[model samples]
Target: MSDVSRLADRLQRVLARAQEERTERDELVDGPDGTECAWAAHERDQMWKAVNALRADDGRPSIPLDDIVQVERQAAGHSDYSRKFALYCAELAQK
Candidate 1:
């Protein structure tokens, strides 16, 4: 498989795992110092890095600030819903 495809797959998995954990915790995953929240953010950063690695323009891993399309929140069959941010990558349009 191509390197970009492989990296994308890994990012997808990381995102999925973070979502699953947040679902199970039901938004009460935050600790006093917000360790849980921090961990989630870290995972998200790693996922972004994986995506950036696939890009050829720059060597540094980064997601364009404008590429984010939407964010969704889901409930895990509980009283409150958990936030599930979905960042959509912008596609190159042919002129």
Candidate 2:
């Protein structure tokens, strides 16, 4: 596959894992002050930051979570959104 294709795949995996972590954190209802739920929440937050950084471009603002979701919906195809999303992932990964 091409570099953009590879990066898009990686982005998809990362987004999926982030969603899973968010769900796991939300499911926790009776944990200690800073235990299981806290750890998951922290992981979720870090994942979100990573995603936001990945989506940022030079001279452009980072995309919000809602927009990211829309991009995700369109990323499977070889559209302009997919190309930009792949480029963003590549830029972030190189850093």
Candidate 3:
């Protein structure tokens, strides 16, 4: 896929995951413990669900969730962040 499409797909994956936890805070999935590394890994995986959503033949570097704060800052809209933004991007992509 083109670079633009790749970025859109990546954002969609991240947004979808975020929307699922709309009411959730920025805290870890669980309390402080030995799961910090595991939790971080899981979060990174969740944020890249679209890494393979493209064509199977399209081999490319996996997208990484470098800074989650960038996404968190966008969680501001009626209803929810991803829910609304995802819808907007979907609309734009279709046009």
Best candidate, TM-score-wise?
A: 2
User: Which residue pairs collide, candidate 3?
Assistant: none
Error at 80, model 3, angstroms: 4.7
Model 2 residue 11 distance off true place after TM-score fit, in angstroms: 1.1
Model 3 regions lying over 4 Å from their true place: 1-27, 30-44, 55-57, 67-69, 75-80, 84-95
Q: Considering summed lDDT, which 10 consecutive residues are worst modelled in model 2?
A: 30-39
Residue-wise C-alpha lDDT for candidate 1, range 1-95, written one tens digit per residue: 75444443554565667666654443434433345555455444544444455454444445552232122112223342222232222121000
Tens digits of per-residue lDDT for model 2, 1-95: 87656766776566556546564455544322334454344443443466566546433465444444344344436566535554555444443
For lDDT, the strongest prediction is 2
True lDDT of residue 5, candidate 3: 60
Alpha-carbon deviation at 26 in model 3, angstroms: 12
**What would the TM-score be for candidate 1 when compared with the true structure?**
0.36
> RMSDs, each prediction?
8.2, 9.1, 8.0
- Of 1 and 2, which scores higher on TM-score? 2
Ranking of candidates on lDDT, top first: 2, 3, 1
State the lDDT of candidate 3 residue by residue for 8-65, as single tens digits.
Answer: 6666677566546644444445422334334344543454444333322365433334
- The C-alpha local distance difference test score for the whole of candidate 3 amounts to 0.44
Clashing residue pairs in all predictions, respectively, total: 0, 0, 0
lDDT of each: 0.40, 0.50, 0.44
